[model samples]
Target: MFATRRADLVLILVALIWGSSYLSAKTATAALPVLAVLFARYAISALACGALIGLRRRPRRWTRDEVRSGSVLGITQAVVLAVETYGVAHTSAANAGLIISLTIVLTPLLDRREGRRLPPAFFVAAGLCVLAVGLLTSSTGLHAPRLGDALMLAAAVIRAGHVALVGRLTVGRPVNPLHLTTVQTVVGTALFLPLATPHLPELAHSSATTWYQLVYLALFCSVFAFLAQTWAVQGTSASRASLLLGTEPIWAVAIGISLGGERLTVWTTLGAALMIAGTYWGQAVERAHRTSTPMEESLRSCRTARADGAARRPGAVVASSPARSSSRSRGDTT
Candidate 1:
């Protein structure tokens, strides 16, 4: 029980860290070019990851699959971050956070490994999310979405694809999460070096507060959040972990309002509530859909069979075979 509580707390903490990252990134980008900020964050993360790996009691060599998967994921992850950073630079942190939560629903749609069709209700929930986005992006009036909000929407889509790719590339493979993360940070550092070269001098002369934000983004948001989440999730169910982590947008809003002096108009307030409701509703629907039992599957099949037979004959009945009791397990990672 104590362990569970501790894990829950840790998960929430990780959520808080991630939630605050938009503001941190926004602050850092204000002081430096977006590319420079990205480069520094990745470089700092790479150094931290390297130091952590070196401090391990027994070092293990990276597996072939780990390196290959990490390289691919690293590039994709960089693209996601680059877009996300640029998005936040042009938008409010609260908006960025809220917009990015669209990933929660988008990921399941992108990743169809189970080959099970989500119930129609899931689509309704998704539609609610789309409505929420509309409200959020057009809080002032019914104009086009701000460039930042549109970029954030794009980031959410790309991040969903990246998450799906992570599942596809890492599932059933023996990949060390730490090693993979280290490789990813290293790869990101390499990818951004050339792009940020010209801005290196400006980045170096950034104020202490800007450097603090950069460090916070790299160390707390990336490394610490990832490690803590991985540890906490190991001590709890994926659903529980996801529930705790899903509070990220709430924290983002609270922090933005309290710390960043961001305001929410009536429309945006309604949009925030709708976004939260839509995401939780969608998450529950997806979880239930994913965890459907053998009996449920059998019943679905039986219904389809009955419909097909009914189409063929005036009155036809189709019976489902007895379902075998089978256990299904779910896993999650950051």
Candidate 2:
């Protein structure tokens, strides 16, 4: 129980850290180019993750398949982040936060296509998600959507793909999550460095405040949050992890409004609320299925045991009866 609580706490921390990530990224991007912000974020994160890998005693060598899987996952992850960073830069942190919650709905659907069927509640949650999106989109009178919102929506889709791929590739495999994170961070850094080349000199001229924001994004948001999430998920159920981590958008909204000077209208607030509720419900449904499965199995096992005992009762009664005893005695005399 203590361990479980610790894991839950860690996951919540991860959510908070991630929730603040949007604001930090937004702040950094305000001063630096998007690619430059991403470059610095990934570069620092890669070093941090590498240092973590070195701390493992008797570290196992990466298999050929692990390398291949990591490379593929890394590239996919890079795209997800690239789009997400750009989206946040162009949109309000609040919008980015709320819109990205689409991943929760998208992931199960993606998994369903991969041969896993979800419960009916999942569809209800999806419907709610759609409604929420409509509410958010119409906050500005249902005109053309902001480019940033569109990019974030796209990022959510790609992020869902990334999640689905991670599940598919890592299952029944010897690939380590730490190794995967390290590889992806390195890949992201390499991919963004060239794009950030023109702005590389801008880093030297940036304010201390901007540099601090970049550091926060790199360390807490990327490295620590990833490590915490991986560790927490290993110790908890997937549904629980989703439920806990899903709080990220709430934090994002909070930080955006309070710290980032972003405004929130009633329509936007309602949309954000709906999005959060839908995501939570979606995860809750899955968690319900996971929790009930073992109980159902145990109940079936008990019923089978009872039926077998009943089937043996007639034989036991016959052997003990007087008629059966007399018949046995006659056979012995013959």
Candidate 3:
């Protein structure tokens, strides 16, 4: 029970960290070009991951699958971050955070593993989220969405696709999360180096506060959150982990208001409430749909039996897999 409570707290902490990232990214970009900020965040993460691997007493060599999967995920993750950063730069942190939570609903539509149709109620919940976005984007009046909000909307869609891709690539594979993360950070560093080269001087001259934000983004938001979530989820149900992590947007709003001095007008406040409600409702619906699927239940039973039978074999080694981790990953797009 203590372990479970500890895991819950860790998950919530991760959520809080991720929630605060929009403001952090916004602050960093204010001091440096977006590309430079991206480069620094990725480079710092890569170095930190490399150091961790070096410190391991018996580090395993990277597997082919891990490299391939990490490369693909790295590119996608970079795109999501690029768009999200740009979006946050132009929008209020609260708006950015709330707008991006659309991923919670969008991912179910994008994820193809189930192959079963979602219930009608799921669509109803999705529609509510859409309405919330409309209100959020039209906070000033009923006109075109601000550039930042639109970009954030686009980010949500792309991030949903990325989450689905993570599940597709990593499920049932013996991919080490640490190795995969390292490869991703390296790929991101390489990808951004040329783009950020001209801005290196600017990045170097950034104030200590800006550097602190960059470090926070790289270490706490990316590396630490990923590791802690992975650890915490192992001790809790995917549903429970997701529930706690789902509080990210709330933290985002609270931090934006309390620390960033961002405000939400009546329309935006209503939008925020709607978004929170729609996401939780949608999440519950999707979870119920997934758990009640007969085919999925049968497949899960077969896999469990196979695993048990293999465990009884004379020379069998059960690899630590992220099959369940992928489910938790669906809701975790910063």
Candidate closest to the true structure, highest TM-score: 1
Error of model 1, residue 10, in angstroms: 0.3
What's model 3's TM-score? 0.88
Better of 1 and 2 by TM-score: 1
Model 3, 4-62: lDDT tens per residue? 99999999999999999999999998889999999999999999999999999999988
The 0-to-1 C-alpha lDDT of every candidate, in the order given, reads: 0.92, 0.85, 0.94
State the lDDT of candidate 2 residue by residue for 1-334, as single tens digits.
9999999999999998999999898888888888888888889899998888889898878777677888888899889988999999888898898899899888878865335467899789878987887777656565566888889989999999999898888888888777887888888888888888998899778899998998899899888888788789999988778778888999999989899898877877788888999988887876676567668888999977776787788654222358878999999999
lDDT of predicted model 2: 0.85
Superposed by TM-score, candidate 1 places the C-alpha of residue 153 at a distance from the truth, in angstroms, of 0.0
How far is 161's C-alpha from truth in model 1 (Å)?
Answer: 0.2
Model 2 clashing residue pairs (backbone)? none
Best by lDDT: 3
Q: Candidate 2: where is the Cα deviation over 4 Å? A: 289-334
Candidate number that wins on TM-score, 2 or 3: 3
